[model samples]
Target: MRYAYDAQSGQCLKFVYRGYQGNGNGFDSKEECEDQCARSLYDFA
Candidate 1:
C-alpha cells in the first residue's frame, strides 16, 4: 500500500501500488504525506 496527497482535499489517501516505477510524489504513509504536504495547511502564523 501507498499514499498520495490530494491537493483539493488537502489529505493523504491510500491505495495499492500495482507496478514498480519510481517518483518523489508517493508517500509511504498518511503521516509521512501529512508531514511533508499537509503541514503547510495547518501551520499557524
Candidate 2:
C-alpha cells in the first residue's frame, strides 16, 4: 500500500494498493501518483 499527502497541509490525499486482490487505487509510478494528487488539489481549489 502507498499513500500520497498534501505538501502544505500534510493531509492524506490518495491511497494506492498493489496486490492480487485489487481493492484500492493504483498508480503506475510515484510520478503518476503525485500528478493525480496535484490534479485533485486543483480540482477542489
Compare the candidates by TM-score and give the number of the best one: 1
Instruction: Give the alpha carbon lDDT tens digit for every residue of 1-45 in model 1.
Output: 988888787678987877688566588888898797766666753
TM-scores of the candidates in the order shown: 0.66, 0.46
Stretches of candidate 1 off by over 4 Å are: 39-45
Q: Which ten residues in a row have the lowest lDDT in candidate 2?
A: 16-25
Q: Across residues 1-45, which tens digit of lDDT does each residue of candidate 2 receive? A: 465555687454555464667533356556766777778879999
Residue 26 CA error for candidate 2 (Å)? 2.1
What stretches of model 2 exceed 4 Å from their correct place?
1-24
Q: What are the root-mean-square deviations of the candidates from the true structure over C-alphas? A: 3.1, 4.8
**True lDDT of residue 3, candidate 1:** 89
Residue 30 local lDDT, model 2 = 60
